[model samples]
Target: MTPITTFFRNLEAKCCASCGQVISEQAESYATECYTCQDQASTDAYKHYYKKN
Candidate 1:
């Protein structure tokens, strides 16, 4: 399947590519990583999951 970009409403949910966490529409616009996952990550280094702060 194609990579998830924008979130969809009234439809199926999406998962984070890094941590498998559920991605919410209100939490973001594009889909690749969830807020929690992204919060602990840098834009360039997102290959793995890590707690940054």
Candidate 2:
């Protein structure tokens, strides 16, 4: 593959919020219970607290 093509392919892809894992390129939907959806700030705060413990 060309350098430009390879660069784009290596680019970070969309991901799921609940798991923080990457979603497939063909993924139809892109939202979880919170975070990436409605309760984004709250989800982030929870994750922060959970990680700090």
Best by TM-score: 1
lDDT, candidate 1, 1-53, per-residue tens: 54455333435667899999888665445668888877777654654444453
Q: What C-alpha lDDT do the candidate models reach, one value each?
A: 0.67, 0.62
For candidate 2, the lDDT comes to 0.62
- Per-candidate TM-score against the hidden true structure: 0.46, 0.29
Query: Over the full model, what C-alpha lDDT does candidate 1 score relative to the true structure?
Result: 0.67
Candidate 2 local Cα displacement, residue 19, angstroms: 23
In candidate 2, list every pair of residues with a backbone clash: none
**Model 1 regions lying over 4 Å from their true place:** 1-11, 26-28, 43-53
